[model samples]
Target: MTLASTGTVIEVETRAGRVRGAWRGTPGEGGASAAFLGIPFAEPPVGDLRFAAPMPKRPWEGTLDALEYAPTAQRGDPGVTLIPEPSIPGDSTLNVNVFTPAPGKTTALPVLVYIHGGGYFAGSPASPWYDGAAFNRDGVVTVSISYRLGFDGFGWIEDAPLNRGVLDWMLALEWVRDNIAAFGGDPARVTIAGQSAGGGAVLTLLGMPAAQPLFEAVYCISGAAADVSVDEAEAFGRRLAEAGGVTPDRAGLSSLSEERVLELQKQLTAPAEGGNPLDGLRQFVDGGLTLGPVIDGDLVPLKTVDAIRSGIGADKPLVLGATDDEFSMILSEAKDKLRWIPSRYLLGKVGLTGKARSAYVAANRTVAKKGTAAIVGRYLTDRMFRTLALRIIHARGEAPTWLYRFSWTSPTFGMAVHCIDVPFFFDCLAADKVDAIAGDHPPQSLADAVHAGAVNFITTGDPGWPRYTAASGETRVYDDPSTVIRDGYAEVASLLPS
Candidate 1:
């Protein structure tokens, strides 16, 4: 079947049941598309199902409404931000939203499945920045998904399955494989992408044997796999249980209200006494109780980095990137304190001292002019994001990997901080929310370059750049006039702690 006309309703069949979606824009309009929102892919992980691996949604007899977005998992208020973070309330949090150029068609289009990021604690598929209309207009089917988060999804309960969030992702991909053809998506040509914690999920899923067949490519932005040890996860879990005033078991956690769980999560995730204000600011930081996939012997098997080093998904294409000033967003908040810290003290934290510290200081004179906060931000950006991106590139063994560094500094902060590239990559610079970060009249040329490159990568295997190699270390730098650089972070590489 072809796409429905403007303002028309379209119905499609899936293995579980039927869903009715609506056309997003008028036909013949520039951004015309079909949107299928709030389609359940798994049973709500509520009540007894909480903390357990996600189960398949029970088949429904009638067509389900796919017009409005479904409720997202329980999460704390995100406070004020330039980015939009909308959360709805309900148990049907495990859902998927699909957008396509042709909704009821048999033509198998390339698919891009995006996972939202909120440090694994908060975020929703309902965010306006995640709209897939641009992708749909580019001849691709786009899917955004919601998964259980925090304690219910990643807390290490004693008797429950580990990495419930990963399971939710797996179930969503399975649903796509079974039903996306009805929505004009090619199950075999799927590309999974995510940002921050969601990016970490993509890397973790790349390492999972069961998830290998679900997607053909991956795009990880400013995130990496959780490196939590089993002992560390259990210790954090026990601490979380105490914070919630409950026993460290599935039953105890399930008994508590979602509000109480979120309260405990916030308390647990706060920086420890006198800890660096930057500790948990970025998605890669090891903030206690900010739930992530565990290296459970069964589901996770091993650490994601290790799995990648061992050549899991080594044949798959990957696009890995991080912003130049990733931690600047959080550092800007503690500028006063950052000014007082000694350079030696900062260097010591990362195990650099004496000549090593001196060399790093001399090599990074550009950032030194910005003060201690900028220095610290540079260190964390490299340690938490750039280093990880390079390591993954080095580890992927013959996989065609493309590396990029987003250097489009925001007018407000003068740094290409975290999440700044979301709008550029999505080609949504026109969205009002983007003005908060990119500033008014942000360069459209850069957006076109970034978006086109990503679209090229999604459509074909390459993104019109040289594949990354340890020897060459070539990377695309997204700026006013984008340029490719060799060994972009070689100076900072040695200063990183082993």
Candidate 2:
């Protein structure tokens, strides 16, 4: 197989048309491969398309260039880091990036479709860290997808439906179902995985009736199944509409420019004090102007947790968990807010209690070197991750669930920070340049251990760890040296109010 770069192009057949993509080589030159980058899975939502449910892409005549990534969702930069403008055109912001070892070959390999995390406001599959080169080398076909974010993707309108971002995700999955086999992926062995908001998307997909049979398994990192209600989402949408000076209707708001819509989204997505944007920004489940799939009569008639509890998608294996210090990213908040500052606290005044407050304060004092930052990290970590994972693990269920804790500390971040463990799972740890932010190189053995667990899960439906059952309460802790820790943090879970 001939290795190539931007200059090389390969053609791929999609439901819309034959698309061209750039070629890249896997490490050690096992084979030549091609990746279709930035191919729009749905129609551009720009102009008259804004806030509308994702429309199917019209069939094209000949070949389309799939070489570059499309522009990110309307909100643009998710405030995490800078990313380049869309390499392709169109406003719907629905796109996918595919990596294949044998670009033109027809083989049904296991498929791993990835959804990016940007708190539903920001993030793109084009993030350097999301490179799929390593997974290509590992014999799996990988696809990274970008969907609408913020108001454009999730905002509600009195006239429009809910969770447009979710609709985009569903469309991307539909694209995968139709075209992945052409890239040598088994449509039946698909595994949907994500980090943070992306993880939340995974849970959302599991709860979606339309998303059923599209993915056989799901793996989530640092996310939970339940979030805002329909009413909450609608209220947020109303705020966005008022801010944008448009009626909360598709036709009215669709007239605005993509940038304007994105700016309004940014303005409204401000995270509450002491809460990460990912946790703070959510699709409201309210009844109007934001009527998304809710416990309403249609779409999402049941809560996700309830659906799972009743064996809705129990045939599928689920591997979900979070990092030990998932909140380290938000720990940089002001020192004053890190303390007994009740106004901005995520848990609110009523949630913090005597022993719990004392334990938090004492923990803060104990972490003297890091000062209030340590305390803030602890609070956000528990608020964002620990409680959610424990809730899912303990929730009554018979679906074979595997739970894990990403504890491997980076020389730079100390303990697996929020999104730290993602690259390792895709086996592209070295390609993402995360080492630069992580401050130091990760241990090689640690990479191997993490990679092994992911590979096992992808192939066997089990993550090579003990299954989590309410009675047994098993958990796999991933550290520099990994171990199976049974009920390691049960007390922390119990602390959250039932």
Every candidate's lDDT: 0.81, 0.68
Per-residue accuracy of model 1 over 294-396 as CA lDDT, tens digit each: 8887778777778898888887899989899876666678777778888657656655568877877788888877888787778777767787887787778
Off by over 4 Å in 2: 1-8, 26-31, 74-78, 81-92, 224-226, 271-297, 332-350, 355-372
Worst 10 residues of 2 by lDDT: 282-291
TM-score, every prediction:
0.93, 0.85
Best model number under lDDT: 1
Residue 26, model 1: lDDT of 78
Deviation of model 1 at 77, angstroms:
1.9
* Model 2 Cα lDDT, one tens digit per residue, 322-374: 87677655555554555544322433332455667655555445443455555
